[model samples]
Target: MAILKQYKKSDGTTAWFYKLYMGKDPITGKERRTTRRGFKTKKEACLDLARLQLEIESKGLNNNSVRTYRELYNLWMSQHTLNIRNTTEQRVRNYFTNQILPSF
Candidate 1:
């Protein structure tokens, strides 16, 4: 479910926002909700809310898929090495390959 409302901005202008019920946390068993604000008009807020609802319906809440340790390490390394020097990247890779990957 979603609730849409209008509010007065600091400049005395009206804006729209929506509070959406996004189901519960699978692990924690607690409710989840999301609020989007600062829309210029109610139509804009409703459009975004519809899009979000459609996305949740199509993809469902828990989107993660199981991955092996090696796959996870490779994915992490790809991002972790992007801004680091080549030597630092190699050192991190070596630590994972020799010490971490072996244990896992």
Candidate 2:
């Protein structure tokens, strides 16, 4: 289930509201809040809430795990440069050693 709430905006000219759902983090198993936008009209609010409800029902609400920099870089290299020739490999290695590794 999700939390439905409403409030007045800072300017007091408009009303803001939102629907918040609790989801567990996939990697950590920690509870996290997912909120949909607030709108002036009740229809708009309901529409946002319905969209979120659909997403939660279909996808389940776990955040995907993050990949470390090294992991990402290696994956990128494999996809982008692993097919290159030996000369290109040498150039890439030189660039990694002189530019990328030092900076990172």
lDDT of 1 by residue, 1-104 (tens): 99999999989999999999999878778998999999998899999999999998898877766478998888888898889999999999889999999998
Residue 53 alpha-carbon offset, candidate 1, angstroms? 1.2
Give candidate 1 misplaced runs (Cα > 4 Å).
4-17, 37-44
Point to the candidate with the largest TM-score: 1
Give candidate 2's TM-score.
0.53
Question: What are the Cα lDDT values of the candidates?
Answer: 0.91, 0.70
**Judged by lDDT against the true structure, how good is candidate 1?**
0.91
- Give me the overall lDDT of model 2: 0.70
Q: What RMSD, rounded to one decimal, does every model reach?
A: 3.1, 8.4
- Worst 10-residue lDDT window, candidate 1: 59-68
